[model samples]
Target: MIQNEIIETIETIETICSRRSVRKYTADSVSDEAVLTMLECARFAPSGLNNQPWRFIVVDDREIGRRLSELTHYSDIVASAPLLIAVFLDTDASYNRDKDLMAIGASIQNILLSAHSLGLGAVWLGEILKNKESVSKILNAPGSFELTAVVAVGHLDESDPGTAERKALDEIVFKNKY
Candidate 1:
């Protein structure tokens, strides 16, 4: 049991560390099974009071994806990726506003990590929030749903997108108090 646990832990760490924001992807489409697996992982993400306020609008239509791409600077990725998932906060299901938003963020992270584990590349497009209203309208989402993020996903074109540099732990972490 311990050996299995350690192996699982190692695999999880590898997946997290190796995951990168893939802006380029192949023309091939993502499988329905793969997309559903990602969403299943997202639904299990921790939520405040277990309200589970996160809602997703999966957009696979090329025309709709193009329209959405116009709202973000990451237009190339959005327009070209085989799949797009618009994460939304269902206001009616929220408990506390701030906590629910954090929960939604966790949900989005789950989607990204799961996509990576499934050998699919995904980029979370938050800059699209500047045109949140327009995005909502395009997706025909309910008024109660607030746009949180748009993730572009597909089979990666690049073999390795490469890792980004990060600040040392000591620079960001504090023992007790800052």
Candidate 2:
């Protein structure tokens, strides 16, 4: 019963599931159009009470990207990517901080899915997360929004990695009463 778009999205998820933390990329840039589309998808992710407390800041300027890379101690992986997304969680949302954080995490899923569907590659940049305040100032983000993480994206330099080793289903899945 899947719609064509839904089926395409499933295939996209599978492709992204094979994605690795790509550390290398050519200097080619990601188009503004692609970045726009990714943000559009992120805008639609579910949020608690529809609070939708996420603000996305896209950084594609090489100098800005380099400065952000420096401020957050991002590795070559981040520096090489043509696009960097500053995922902001609006703390002023109608929910508690935890809810805001949880909601932002869901929105990141949408970004990933959309990027994958578009044939671009992205790696979740976690180090940027540890330096939120500094990152905010560097990016000129509003004080009300908290920096959560950066998603570095670009055309990949390597092929998609195959299925990863995962825990057995029996080990993690539980029945209704478990």
* Per-model tally of clashing residue pairs: 0, 0
Of candidate 2, the 10-residue stretch with the lowest lDDT total is: 156-165
What is the C-alpha lDDT profile of model 2 across 1-178, one tens digit per residue?
4699898888877865665555556678888889989998888988878989999888888887777777666666666778889899877774867777777887887787677778777777777777788889888988888888899888867654523677877788887345
Score each candidate by Cα lDDT: 0.92, 0.78
**Against the hidden true structure, what lDDT does model 1 obtain?**
0.92
lDDT of 1 by residue, 39-85 (tens): 99999999988999999999999999999989988899899999999
TM-score of structure candidate 2: 0.84
Measured against the true structure, the TM-scores of the candidates, in listed sequence, are 0.95, 0.84
- Model 2 clash tally, residue pairs: 0
Which portions of model 1 show Cα errors greater than 4 Å? 159-163, 176-178
Error at 12, model 1, angstroms? 0.5
